[model samples]
Target chain A: AQSVTQPDIHITVSEGASLELRCNYSYGATPYLFWYVQSPGQGLQLLLKYFSGDTLVQGIKGFEAEFKRSQSSFNLRKPSVHWSDAAEYFCAVGVFGNKLVFGAGTILRVKS
Target chain B: EAGVTQFPSHSVIEKGQTVTLRCDPISGHDNLYWYRRVMGKEIKFLLHFVKESKQDESGMPNNRFLAERTGGTYSTLKVQPAELEDSGVYFCASSQTGLGSSYEQYFGPGTRLTVT
Candidate 1:
């Protein structure tokens, strides 16, 4: 069984501040990792995904995540936060081609 | 292109009542999945349908939950005798075949089901 853990339940950062959301996973082998964001009254949107490639993967909306195999972590990061970046973020781990296991999710609050 | 779409953006039902949620996947997508997010809990998978056949349903919580996809187009998930714990947001996602490294699942806005 695969599982994901997001340490932070909520985080507040000022606009233009750097932000990082922690994510750790437990899997038997190298797993597929993904970051998704959900705005109010919206569906989850893929931020980025990590399969087998460079450690750092870039995604839309100026978001990026690094896959650290040793630490079993894939934390999402953004250089500068904007007010529009306030949303709920989720980290998910995919098992083979089966279902995905998601983290508890972290709510991001951007303060101006 | 239009994303996945679900019906009845919000539904309020009573305990012991029945609620059916509909999901229309992206055109040409062969894989459709159902997931639910209970309050303060992680989103959990319910089932997966490959066209008209169910590929995997190990995540279904109980037998009371029934999901079907006819003509390999749209899918319906019906819960008979709904319980208060069943209150949550039901989300539908779809992905095309050979998703490769970009195995991204397109999602629907989800239907909020409230069982009071």
Candidate 2:
């Protein structure tokens, strides 16, 4: 079965500190990976996506993700943590061009 | 370009009742999808519609959930005889069709449903 695993349930980091949320997926084939963020009372927003080529993908809000095929991981990273960046992050894999299968999600807590 | 939108940002109802949620995808988008998140858990896929047609309904939890797209325009999901387990935030997303891998879904604010 194809599934996404986000190992961390909650993470806390000081403001200006670097952040990395781990994500590993189990899929049978090369999959379309994506990172989405849902801020408080807001809709899910696309952080970054990886279809193919150039493993490292950049997205909005100073966020970036690298797709490691060998590891079956597409972890999300940010050089600096912002208070506004604290939200629930989800890792998803698109299958058959029809729908998305999402991970359990990681909650980031930015502490000042 | 307006993003996808869902109606009744929040709905509170008793169990065994009916609730119908609506979604209006971004204009010109050919694909619309429904998802549900229970108590802030993983957002699970519910179904998919391609221009008024059901492309995939495998994700639907049970037959109590009925989704429809009118004339390939806006869409609605009706959950009849709601159960306590059905309480969650229902989300709707939309995307355009592309040749290769162009499945970027734009989501809505979501409708929070509370069943008692």
Candidate 3:
């Protein structure tokens, strides 16, 4: 079974600060990784995905994630996070095209 | 274009009651999915529908849960004799195609099912 781990449960940062959310996965073969964001009382929106080829993947809303095979990590980053970026972020690993194992989310709070 | 749409944005039912959640996928989308997030837990896949067919339902937890996607346009998940553990946000997502990496699922504002 594939599983994902997100170390941070909550993170607080000042607005306009750079941010990084860590994600690690455990899979035997090559992994398909993704990052998703969710606001309160809403559904998830995909931030980005990494399947093959490039290690660095860019996503919507100025978010990016890098897949590191050696460390089994796909960390999401934003150079400058706006107040609107505050949300619960999830990391996931998919296999065989059907199910996805998600990580416990990291709630990001932006301070003004 | 409208993204996925789920009906009954919120539902509160007593334990042992029955509830059904509906999801209307985008037109022309062939792939539809059901996922849920329990309190303080990560979202988990419940099933997948390719048109009206159940392509994969391995994630479905038990017999009390039923899902259908008749006619391939919309899908529904029903829970009979709901348990407290079933209280959570149920999300529906759809993509144009299921075979390729281009299938990025667009999600609907979930239906929060609260079992009292």
Ten contiguous residues with the weakest lDDT in model 3 chain A: A92-101
List candidate 2 segments past 4 Å from native.
B100-102
- My TM-score estimates for the predictions, one after another, are 0.97, 0.97, 0.95
Pull out the clashing pairs in model 1: none
- TM-score (chain B) of candidate 2: 0.96
Q: Model 2, range B9-77, lDDT digits (tens) per residue?
A: 999999999999999999999899999999957899999999999998898999999999999999999
Estimate, for each residue in B41-91, the C-alpha lDDT of model 1 and write its tens digit.
Answer: 999999989899999998899988999999999999999989999999999
In order, the Cα lDDT scores of the candidates are 0.93, 0.93, 0.89
Question: For each candidate, what is chain B's TM-score?
Answer: 0.96, 0.96, 0.95
Fnat for model 1?
A: 0.68
Docking class of 3: medium
Give the C-alpha miss distance for residue B99 in model 1, angstroms. Answer: 5.4
- For model 3, what is the alpha-carbon lDDT of residue B74? 91
In model 2, the Cα lDDT at residue B93 comes to 97
